[model samples]
Target: MTTELETQIAKYQKWRENLRVTLEAYQAWLEGHGHADIQRSLRIYDLVESLKSDRVILAFLGEFSRGKTELINAIFFSGYKQRLLPSDIGRTTMCPTEIFHDPSDEPYVRLLPIETRKSEESIGSLKDKPVEWVTIKLEVDSQEEMAKAMASLAEVKVVDVDEADKLNLLNDSEFVTTTVIKQSSGKVEIPCWRHALINFPHPLLKNGIVILDTPGLNALGTEPELTLSMIPSAHAVMFLLGLDSGVTKSDLEIWQQYIRDSVSRRIAVLNKVDLAWDELKDDAEINASVERQLDETATTLELSREHVIALSAQKALVARIRGDTALLAKSGIETFERMIADEIIPAKQQILRAAVAREIGGMLESSMASVRSQFEATTNELKSMSTLGDKNRDLAKKLLAKFEEDKARYGRHMESFNT
Candidate 1:
């Protein structure tokens, strides 16, 4: 029941893998031939491999309770109660969270606990916290299965693994006894509990796509993996908003200072439209008001009005899951979905996607020169009396075709996000 978008992403990933195998084969052949021309082909193959694994990471960032989770809901979920990011206002996600695909030869959400590390001997500890990192191996396949992995990360509590032995409740040696540990009258020391360790063999992410759902920038004392690793590596950033709140000074500050600085493409989304529109007249009027606000805000930021997408994350998430666009709009979700297509997805296409591009581009300029050189040599050869003209014509045709094909394939890899 996967949608066209999912299938398209799958196809592109498969194509990339096929190309990788082909390029590897070419490289192997070039090694056997040991000619200067063959070396050029090997280099071209290496370039293709780089392009295939050319990752485009998308990071979600905002303040607590800013509907960052709801925006994730709109993008990743597709059903009734389409809830991806936890939407609790009071308990607004306290830890760093992540949801991504992992297509290992043996796939599992290798949940690396904060205090532990995976090793052959045993779970080891780092800084007097507990033993080291041990991955919580969870098996999964489809999207629904992936949700379980995220939920497991959310549900688990942190306890001292050594303390678990005292309770005689030691089910697994790798299990760390989770606790809120010690509390100082005002300040408290709680045993750290992690959010999630999700891994899946999703077609989109395997070739190099990682989508992150963060609890804004203000979260404390949780895992540092998010800010240190994920954020810095992301190719794009999605900034969510609430329609009731609109664009605030804090939002502007974060955008101008942090998110905009790191990510080349930033998407500003207005969520919770259902609540805001309920207070307005007709749908058109509600939309008009949002447009007006979008313009005012974008102008202040010196960003294009198109950059601020007016959406109901709550609605779009539900609609996509139910495959009901009418219901999505009725629920105020259509706006989010449309915004994703118009702004975020297209930006991905323009930035990272190039069909046979990265490798070919590298080879295009370099290989063509060699091809021409070889062609001249053939023309000058006395043995080419009957074959010189044909060989030269063939090389010329191939050289022109290479670049021509690259230009035509510009957006093929982008089709996954294009919708």
Candidate 2:
């Protein structure tokens, strides 16, 4: 059974493959026709490699307890028949987590330690140096083992205020109130890892989909790399807001500071719509109430109503696990998935097309110009030789000499062009 998301990604992958083949054909054409050069060959090679490794990154952003992680599970991991990532009540995903499939590597979780924050190196630079991370192997065959390993994302360590301050984990105004726990021993609790990378072999991930689950504002505020680089680089971003809490001050702050202008394809997800379900009222009443909330949320976030999605991620996951069509339909998960398939993926494809054109369009134009010049020179040489038969002997000799000179110059120019 192919899903809409799977179908769309398959089409995307096929498009990329076709583009690769076209580039290869173009390379052959240039070489066969004597237009290939070192610089042009290198550019083509880099473009093909980039296309082979291209990924569509979807980032989920929100404050804590907004069901962001649960939404991720519902969308991508419902087949495991359990919650893949730790999505508990409050502050579940402590650090930024990136989930993707790297075919060259086995299934594993690479966690960067909190102590690494003391170093001057950013998380982006640390990814290249595997020695800085703690690697945990995952048993893909065992769901229980995989869950246990993934639970480490929520792991925390208690450190004194001084150590916490040194790690930049203690922000008196924001971190203490939102992300950390103050204990009787005068120690503060913080996330054990700075960032997490999970290389799992899921179908969507195998098809070049990267899922980025980010922590709340406290972590976002402290990690400048995430705000400055990662989030903005994602192809699309979904900002979750709970229906029960509406949009809090912290949520608004996160939107303004991190999400609002970072990505072009931004979605405001109104999660936990099941909370509005009432036994005493009919479905119409419940729907009206939900729509009213959605309108309010859209207005608050200053987004169009079409971009605001309302869904219950918990119910959707349960419906998927249980194979309940009714609950699944009511959960509105299918609608959201369709939007991603129909809107986001196509938009990303257009951006990629524009970028590729900008990179290779100039080289192609130059190659065509060189071919045109060579064709004109060859035509003139043939015309000169044909006219030699009707001229006097001396004139014919001069024409032949000029024709040979032109041919030799053309050969030299071609040699220079190829080299």
What is the Cα-based lDDT of residue 139 in candidate 1?
46
* Candidate 1 C-alpha error for residue 409, in Å: 30
The lDDT values for all models are 0.53, 0.88
Measured against the true structure, the TM-scores of the candidates, in listed sequence, are 0.66, 0.89
User: For residues 1-419, could you state the per-residue lDDT of candidate 2 as single tens digits?
Assistant: 45788899989989989998888878887887677899989989999999999999999999988999999999889999999999999888999999999999999999999999899999989999999999999999899999999999999988898888888777767444535666657798989999999999988899899999988877788888898999999999999999888889989999998988888888999999999888999999998988898899889888989999899999999999898989999999889989999998998889889988998999978876876687687767768676768557677777777777777776765554444
Identify the leading candidate in terms of lDDT. Answer: 2
Show where candidate 2 strays beyond 4 Å.
Answer: 174-178, 372-419
TM-score, cand. 2: 0.89
Worst 10 residues of 2 by lDDT: 174-183
Window of ten residues with lowest summed lDDT in model 1 = 410-419
| Global CA lDDT computed for model 2 | 0.88
Model 1 stretches with alpha carbons more than 4 Å out: 1-22, 25-29, 36-49, 79-85, 105-131, 139-149, 152-191, 194-196, 220-229, 321-323, 330-419
TM-score (C-alpha) between model 1 and the true structure: 0.66
